[model samples]
Target chain A: MKHIKTLNTRSLQESMKKGGCGECQTSCQ
Target chain B: MVHQYRNNGYNIVLDVDSGSVHVVDDLVYDVIAFLKDDLSKADDAVTARFAGRYSPEEVSEALEEIRALEKNHQLFSRDIYRDAVLDFRNHPTVVKALCLHVAHDCNLACRYCFAQEGEYHGVRALMSYETGKAALDYLVSHSGNRRNLEVDFFGGEPLMNFEVVRKLTAYGRELEKMHDKHFRFTLTTNGVLLDENIMDFCNREMDNVVLSLDGRKEIHDKMRPSRNGKGSYDLIVPKFQKFAKQRKELGKQYYVRGTFTHYNLDFARDVLHFADLGFDQISIEPVVAPADAPYAIRPEDLGTIKEQYDLLAQEMIRREKEGRGFTFFHFMIDLTGGPCVYKRLSGCGSGTEYLAVTPWGDLYPCHQFVGNEEFLLGNVTEGVKRSDLVSIFKSCNVYARKECRDCFARYYCSGGCAANSWNFHQRIDSVYEIGCELERKRVESALMIKAALAD
Candidate 1:
């Protein structure tokens, strides 16, 4: 298995997901 | 669950529970699918499944590699936060950001504006300094232990009440000093009343400025026009360009934000147009409107929209290779450290940790919910009046969202927008399927771009 990126592995309490802030939903707000 | 997909000639496997991403060979990818949730059957499955394709030695090697990753606690990680998330949701949170509607009025009429040209389904008015000051005070007082606070000057046009914005900012600074807090100010403007003084002040005081200009001249003009029925593109574009340039030079953050409606299915061109116009930081998003609206994105447009994202991603990679890469807001993925686990599950602290204050100092869950009276939390002078509403918002998490429970992008989008769900299904816990589809595509495209750049 070739690891690409593992942002968090220590604990689920500190996990960081693979996307940025979905600010797209804040359209014209 | 390990969600695997192929994009741009790369096989990607995402361990949903652990937030681990892997790029593996076709044999390992297929082996993972066969193994599914049972690691005990990995040896038997790998050998039997790939008998005709991969040799015994290659299958054994791939199986060992998979076992090594699993041993490292990177694959098949259990959902440790599943139960804790419920506790996290119930815990009281202090307000960290306020989207202050400084003016419920706008100079230009944006046809797709959710705020109904800034009046928010109410009378057009500017927020008084007293009201803004009270809003700041409320933020400072309620923000326990959190040293940094955010205040966004949002409106039909914040510049209409520019003086109030200036005063509120000054007052916010003073409150920060007194309360030992730091205020990060942001301004979202339509750019009609953006003058030299405003630009200078924003550069000096505002941490980020969001300038609205919807793509090309014709597209933007058709959607955004003045009360006198004149297009606003010619007036706003030059100002926005100048503002963006100065922000770039000063090392401040700003973006030329736009919206894409059904009128522009070829939205990729508009994104390229923004890039060509010399604005590096940009965001062009799908417009959220009622399905019956003439410009609303219909179900049939999904295919075109997803294609646009793919096209935009490919072009962005090309630009990066040419050393002229611009940051697309949605495409930015922080590999080192993204938002914390709580943020990933609970989403943007919309109603709980972040609230929107209207011109009259009344609070709502967020700016999008301003006009809806049922969502009124309370005025600044009086604290959040409806604790029940707060509880309801607190319950909004990825786990609580039925549609998001099985979605692979659930952690990324955090169950999509609550306001949007409420608008569409009248249930905050539901999901907007269209937004979900687009979000998934964007995530895939972003990962593909990352892979290309890494190569």
Candidate 2:
């Protein structure tokens, strides 16, 4: 296993706008 | 021109060109329709239609009212998109995002998965590092001076190709300085393969991470199970909670997205469950399955679905009032800047602003079309063929559909999703009836919430 590294997260406000409908079921689901 | 509908005694008119919505009374409504048909119609013809409803003097006055509406460009307006379409026809299309299907295999066997055992009806495969790199290069070169671009490392399970994802994100970072374009990354996972390293990388470079946990343990385990028939809910919950807390601490965006099927009619419980589990941002959507799929949300489920939406709305409002507000993804209707007609009509960007790449580098309009060759636009090497893309852009928009032209929720819901349209009606432009009803119910719930908030 690779060494686990830490990453920073954007604020919840900034986070809400990301992602796309790259999957099925869940989109309409 | 506009799309108008009579809803509950109110005439809802959506100005197609401007994307403005107007709600008016029966008198104003009938006059607008009459003027829309023929603004030059003599007062007698108007009187003949409404002869018993109103006196001749009233009809004359209504004609004046119609003329006023026309003067304001609210009725009998000229088509605004004709010239705009011609100009765009001469211009080039800019590609902003590529949803790369990095892995076409999954560890879980979700009962309602459209991917067909995670194979997409083809042999399971993982996207090569070279193909992923070329997709980024393709986006940079064809991006047309766009400063911002997006790349979604999507799959039956993106982590199945964890090494490729790690290398791809690193390579994209390296290319950013040289190409002068910013790439926003997102990953959607079922959370079956998330570990310390994968979660770390995802939290670091990935702008968004969609953790698929369908609400409650019982519901999730029942709906989504491992290929070996083992429940995955127990394995994922702790990992997801830890990762989500880290993202929240860093202020990064993430969502716990799940799908509700016919079986989970009380779907709002899923949202409440997320809330109970300390998840603030959530997306609980209805399932999209073949009509005959045993778990499909049937037409009879509409009423309960709607009631559940209302219950969810009430809970959302109560949470906000208590200062513990959480976002239910679908209930998010932009009350400001009504989505433009061109955007609303086309629904999801599909072949226009968005495109999906298969594991082998084949390009389709969106992720849903990866296995379906009929929707193949082109490959990363050749770029999107102009003729093929143009055909999709021209044919897939809501403006091209007849039923959508007069729908009350047309402007808000857009034309609906292309994948759903193709799956339901076998045509890209035709939206599914279930999607339409669900959207209308959501819009209605939103409106109800707005009313309650104002009260």
Candidate 3:
């Protein structure tokens, strides 16, 4: 619900800059 | 029971009752067509059995079976999809070269160096010998015999810690011997400490060397002076000339990079000074403001940099056409022509195909965040497996960031550097900071103008 709520008002651009729901933060290397 | 019928090109009927639903859509028509088309009698019987019966429970069971079949189909189809995508990937491998910061400590302290953070001098935390070995090992092991390997050595001043560089170079040579792989090596330096030994090393082993020269004597000296408050240009120019002479004699490639801060923006005449230095390849980079730095660009100053860039690009193009070549350190043309891949704007390759190891044996997404604790991927002591790295890569899709999806320059910029994106905007796929955006726009516009003029 919180993520959905955030998605509702936040521009897709803003959400993307947040690195896509914290997915980019994970250490892949 | 209620019967609902829907048709597009074919007719289908759904009948719902107390515990069963029937779908009798096109069964008779299908049987008639099959029979008319000379279908085998056995096949016709099979079709006819299902044709008249469309009970909800029966249909539900059939649908469940179909769903299970579809799942299996998809599981197998992924291989086919990957194969199709592989064709695109195979056309030309994206150049994902890195200028590894084999050494971080610099000989001189520039006033505007980003590595300086309130007593947290980043230069001192140089990559150790062990760290360099680990990084090289990682690169050699994971590269999977990738045909083209271009490596650049970066630093506060890479020469400040030349011993580690020597070790890495030796390791690289050993790896090459084992794998029979060839690599290109280049060094970017401030040029103050370059001497015969360095020149000899570069001539024999390296492909290209780039020197950081801000511009004319006054500007260069003012911006990049010695820590003892003395001008560096005068001290370094003679050494640069010697290096140039050696490069000419040795037939080695060399480039000069000029970084422009706000202080130098007002002066365009200083650019011509680089031309006088007998250096042909000149690169101009705008002063990049850190995450905490103020975000304001003077319109006039930006215009000045643009004007100089246009003039330089035009001159370089003209000279190149005349068979008298001059190099400008802009990668847009190389990127567009598919000769080089810029990691920053190209895509998120770090932690996916590329990874950086810190001096302390900690893995990172890339070298840009070498000392930053937040960026630590894993420790060497833990001995992370290859499969673990692969899963980590799959999970972190920087391109999926909503901001990146929506940005107009997403294709070109690739959400800028992922590390910068995470640190500054707190998102990996976010648009670059305002200053970066402006600088990129200026460079992009200049490149477009150059391309058009050449055309």
Candidate 4:
């Protein structure tokens, strides 16, 4: 069960690396 | 003028007009029949010619080509076929096993029972010992060389007629020896009549025993009181606890099932009471009332029952996370993704893959329709052939029903149970009753919620 925490962390890191955190400024005036 | 082309062999009616071809009725059955025939022929050819000539890769490629053909044929309706294939591949046996009502007769009479209604008035009779033996023989012979066999003993109360159960258990052991097969047994009982002798036999022979307990003393007493109007709950509940303890000491697997009717919908809190009694698994089932039973809840009240059941499910899920074993049969759709395949689909080789024999040596589609004349497939004595059983299975296809062809859940739930459909609609293809929708929705919602919570 504790390994699930590591898997989640790895998923989050992969998501961050892939720019899935939505960093594009679409509302720039 | 429109040109209509009907494939009689496939039972598919194709209407081609204006250089466009449109598939009617989803053509599920036609495609299934085609694929089954193609696969069978390919298998036969491979077995005959390539006995030792073809390499493993060649055989795999040949099988893959057949599968691809099935896919191409179902290209227009790919999703349906894909889902069906996934279901089939994941669970080879659409129904893992069956629980049969070998004997309907019971020793004690509970007030809130459905078996006592109408035709069942005479139905509380025992299954002949001959029927029991024939059923075992039918199971062993027809299982298609599948090594493992599973059977569950069910009844108005199974142990009341202990002689038959004991004989069947012993007979099963002998059958296992003769066939060199593994057999597993499970029994569900009311627990009032379960004694030392029964427990000893079960502990040795049976794999698991499920005792029905309905919450605390008062609710159980009021709901399932003995025929004499005495509070049978107090006596039965303690006995259940004692049985669980003895099972633990003797290293036997046992669980308790709590049935919730309209009256005991709020007994979720009392679930822990059974847990405290050292019971491992608690299966909560909603009481099923016969169509004309006086105690039956109205259809409208099913919504309330669902709400109550949802709350219980959440609590049970929490308990499960904490390492306490629990299961609610009502929440089985949640436990197993999608509804029960049997409930969703109408026929899956009923008499072909599974079968039941009545007390008089009459064979039927499963135990539920044993005594009913309509469901009788054939007799064991008169040389029941596989072809006859296949025809019986084919007749249960709900696609023939016009209403079922257009149902929203048609692809998944094939017009509810075959016997129920025939009994109610007088046709297997009619749209299922509202109760079927309500139950499926309830379990589906529960499953969705449970998945979301897990995420």
Candidate 5:
């Protein structure tokens, strides 16, 4: 919360949901 | 056109073109919004708006602050692309990650599989070594001035074609030395065919391994049973646990992911279940299927999902207080260092930046479109012959979508997934409402959790 500056809504969704693509991180399942 | 949102005594503004965000306090918030509403409005009118509470001198001082923000280009919306990246569209494309469908054949039959049970609606076959090599070459050559290149050995199960996977990792490494590019590999598996040999090889060669273990045993077995109709949890748990331990020791990247549907509306329990199992990195999401699909999270169930997210947040906080906190992938969004406003506005570079190559050397936008030839860009052999489709997605920024400009969370979500749009609305620019609602709920929950933690 220390001045949360970034706001990537789609990445937030991908981080939560596993659309079966893993490249987002190294990235997904 | 700068837009504003007031939350928790902080003002958050979005400059659509520049993708700049500024967090200011009450007085400054008013000053920014006042000028944004009508920059030409006389200072006397602004004094009347904040009348009695603030004197004219204070309004005049606030005007000074407004000018400062305007000077910084944070108060007004204007195209900053030329200054930021300098003709990004015309810039060479960089293939950072290539999802290679090593085996078109899958061993399990997940009821909700968008890949047509892993065969991708095609004949069951594995990628010939020739195709796999060509795809890797395609990834390397097309990757413009990028040092970090990634390959996801995806399939019905990547383990199905372990030999090619083994061969490709070595081949990719060889290419890395020749091309001076670093190749990072990932293996996404259902974990049915995992063995000591495969695990050992993966631990040594792979950068990250995405093991699919739906949170709860019962729910997973029900949704993702093997061809012989038996629970995979029993077979996968020990191996997955072993890998998790190794990942922790090596500081490697890995996540145990699951999907929650209409059936598991109380999905927070699944998050707890994973934590209890001693897994630290966890991500759970709703299934991306159509509304009419039997297991879709319908409108009525949204409230329940929201409640579950809230409950999960509380549990995470409680565990942290008790010194057992874990990283829930969604809950750890640090906006300060996230992607720039433009990237967030357009979402991931799926079709344009990332390409999924089938075992037969065919290329689709991403893995989701592998079987759907309508999205087929071309084969790896042909090299993206469809510039028309490529331009369509390349031009798909959130501003281009009419509905996104008015959305407060639009800066974060962009315009949702293109594949999802195509599946749900038959077009790339259309939004997927279910995914959008779920995203909004998750973003809300994340902000609430961040606020609580800050407190």
Candidate 6:
């Protein structure tokens, strides 16, 4: 009956990264 | 695919491929689930399906909203990264990170150490300056246009080879200016030899330092002890507390990393223990060991572990409200600005961009795969000899693993740790089922925390 919010509209894979591992799963064992 | 779940009294719908999350009312939640299952049915059938509970008007409105979201490409979005992933290996392989095991020797004797007390199933040795320099040179040469490079000084304990760590860092800093590249150094230590001098140097140089402390004196001392079987908690706690405070004063980052095994299923208390100790950045992870090992987290522990995650998230929300918020590594998520498609599909870049170098300069995919001779890529001096193996590692993605293909947390974890998969199944493109379950729960708890705090 109701839509509260849309957290993200853009496709996450479409973004660009400048540097750093960017993000690919790490809490470094 | 839409993965719907309720947590912290909120119904969350995650459109897997598109990475879009929708928080909806109960009626809309049911309507979306219905539409996902039978998309061919007309709007009338959808309304009739839920007619008993929700009014026809409510169903109609929910359908309209879903349709609008679909039109806007926010719901039920198609996979656009499939083609990109299929040709993943063809892309240039650039080495950007190195887990330099400076010392294949440890000062502590942790019971569940995967590295076998730091020797990593090999002879105990310290990396010579020449070998460490060669590693830095190899990384720079193979980096291929990546300006920001990460070098984690890992080992049985990096501090055991403090002189070598310092030398390698200085060498890396020198190379950075000449090559127009920046080095981000991280050190993961057991905090056994931590002192004022080392702490000062770490605050000045290391970008991030991971201090190992298993929390709660009883739990920590039992798991992580010295060569003489003496508890290290008494020796390390005061040092860690001072180090954490100094890092905060210098505006640097550090984490008090801990490991919780089956012996302590109530790991949430340990996480709180870190918070109460005035350490802000904390991470208490589930210990990874053979399933038969007494300390290993078994299949039966899944339910209790998930509950602990929920409890931790709720407590995190409470702490934030009380102005005592601290960052829990696993609970952090960047829904809006997450990884790019390349990073998401490829994963942590173990064998490709990131590789591990042993003290004697032997190379492996990562630290976890170091001891396994089968995973040896080559030596740092020779560079990666197994380009075919490198290609295989490069090809590993969410789609490569069958279970990961359908897993809701696939993109979030990027097929989980390849080493973990290889350890269990002898295959990189596989799933660690237990880890998968815990990851899903953590993701849900993270989202719930975000929602609760937003309120």
Q: lDDT tens string, model 4, B1-455?
A: 11122221112211110111222222332333344424455545653445565555555454554345335342122123223323432332221233456666665566665455112334555666777777677667755556667667777777767898898889989999998766778787887788889888888988888887777777677766666777777777777888888888887777687666667666565566677667766665555555575555557667676666556666666776777756454454322222233333334445544555444456666654666666666775553544544454544544445655534334334445555555566654454464465555543444343443444
Task: Tell me the whole-model lDDT of each prediction, alpha carbons only.
Answer: 0.84, 0.74, 0.52, 0.53, 0.75, 0.85
Name the candidate that leads on DockQ. Answer: 6
* Candidate No. with top TM-score: 6
| lDDT of candidate 5 over B11-75, digit per residue (tens) | 55555444455555567667667777678888788889888877788777777766665665545
Task: Give stretches of model 2 more than 4 Å off.
Answer: A1-29, B1-90, B337-342
TM-score-based ranking, best first? 6, 1, 5, 2, 3, 4
Q: Which stretches of candidate 1 lie over 4 Å from their true place?
A: A1-29
Model 5 residue runs over 4 Å out of place are A1-29, B1-86
lDDT of 1 at B123: 99
- In candidate 6, which residue ranges exceed 4 Å CA deviation? A16-29
Per-residue lDDT of candidate 1, residues B1-455 (tens digit):
67888987888887777767777778888888888767678476669877889888888887778888788767776667766667667666788899999999988888988998889999999999999999999988998887878999999899999999999999988998799988989999989899899999999999999999899999999999898889999998899999999999999999899999999999889999999999999999899899999999999999999889988998999999999999998887665565556677877778888899999999999998998999999999999999899988888888888787777777678778889999999988888888888888888888778777877
Q: Write the candidate numbers in order of decreasing DockQ.
A: 6, 1, 5, 3, 2, 4
Q: What is the DockQ of each candidate?
A: 0.21, 0.02, 0.03, 0.01, 0.08, 0.39
TM-score against native, each model: 0.95, 0.79, 0.63, 0.63, 0.83, 0.96
Off by over 4 Å in 4: A1-29, B1-78, B82-102, B111-114, B117-131, B245-255, B267-273, B276-278, B290-292, B321-325, B333-352, B383-415, B428-434, B445-449, B452-455
Point out the worst 10-residue segment of candidate 2 chain B by lDDT.
B337-346
DockQ pick, better of 1 and 6: 6
Cα TM-score of candidate 3? 0.63
Better of 1 and 2 by TM-score: 1
Better of 3 and 6 by TM-score: 6
Best by lDDT: 6
lDDT string for model 2 (B1-455, tens) is: 65556432335554434333455556656766776666677778888988787778866776775566456554455545534433443456677788989999999999998887678999999999999999998888887777778899888899999999999999999889998878889999998889998888887899989999998999999989999999999999998899899999999999999999998999999899998898989999999998898899999999899889878988888888889988888877654433333344345666866788989998888888778877778899987665665566545655666777667676567678877878888777777898888887786666545444543
